[model samples]
Target: MQPIILENVIKNYLLDKIQVPALKGIDLKIDAGEFTVIAGPSGSGKTTILNLIGCVDTASAGKVVVGGKETGTLSEKQLTDLRLHTIGFIFQSFNLIPVLNVIDNVEFPLLLQNTLSPKERRERVLKFVDRVGLTQYAHHRPSELSGGQRQRVAIARALVTRPQIVLADEPTANLDSVTGQNIIDLMKEINQTEKTTFLFSTHDHSIMNQARRVIRLHDGKIQANA
Candidate 1:
């Protein structure tokens, strides 16, 4: 089944009453459990596609369905709930809370969901943290860890809810080459074992190669699908 469906999607940004188009007439579908990479240079609408699929941005003129749910009409609060429960996000910058420890940061989404009690929250968070190989750093704040370690914590946080899809935007932009490769490997492993769909927006060819399917965007349109 299709995990993501975008039909005639269009996105525009308004700057001082001038409408600037970002994504124009996009139609795409991503299957479940596929490692899909949306690759392009800056301003190529790569991130826009990820945002649309992740339900952070609504299209100006089209339809977007995630996990078979039509998102064109969902209110902002409803979209937030959809994202919190069904979608996970990783970004170029590791967006962990500075005030919270590793485990606490991982548990934040669950708190938003209000599903698990404190003990269950702690248990689930630690399980993901350990899976991402950060069990020893659970008590440390974001300031206490290396860049790679922080990214691992972000991975754990993103996956803590057992989300159906993970939307990653330039996830390796801040890391060194080796560290970036390791991060991709870890995500790939999770995608393989957990059957989670990973959709990434990146300019990096290394990431594109790692993906099972690659969609290349240029000039606000998809130019290639491999």
Candidate 2:
């Protein structure tokens, strides 16, 4: 089954009592396990589309189905549940809690689910932290890590839940070119090995070149899908 689908999706934001359209009739489908990139310049609606698929925002019109469930029909609680269990997100900023150590930061999401005992949670968190090559830094705080290491922690945190789909918005923007490329490489390795679907937005040409599929947006519409 497709991990994400958007049919004739439209989105608008209100500014000074004026409706500003962001996405204009977008139609998209992201197959399970595909490494896809939504590429566009600023103000081209890349983040807007990701937000809709991630259930962070609602579409103004049309349908958005994630993991075979139509998001518009879900209640607030159901949406929260779906987000917690089915989707993972990586933001441009690391967004890690300053006080939390690497292991705690990666384990924070699991703590919310309350399904696993402390031991099970620790095992899962350690597995991902090791996968992201942060096993040695498990006890380090975010402030103690370099930019690449911090992003690795974020990646580990995102995947610890074992979600079917991961949505990232400019995840490499804050890192240096070498560090950013390394982050992308790590994500690609995880994508290949775990068969987890990844849909991330970025304007970086170097990053876009790594995607198996590239969907380019412009002026709130799709300009290319290759």
- Per-prediction TM-score, please? 0.97, 0.98
Pairs of colliding residues, candidate 1: none
> How much does each candidate deviate from the true structure in C-alpha RMSD?
1.0, 0.8
What lDDT does the true structure give each of the candidates?
A: 0.91, 0.95
lDDT of 2 by residue, 81-110 (tens): 989999989989989999999999999999
For 1-103, candidate 1 gives per-residue lDDT tens digits of 7878999999999989999899989999988888889998899999889989999888999899998788988899889889998899997899999999998
| CA lDDT, candidate 1, residue 191 | 97
Best by lDDT: 2
Worst 10 residues of 2 by lDDT: 75-84
Best by TM-score: 2
* Model 1 lDDT, residue 123, Cα: 87
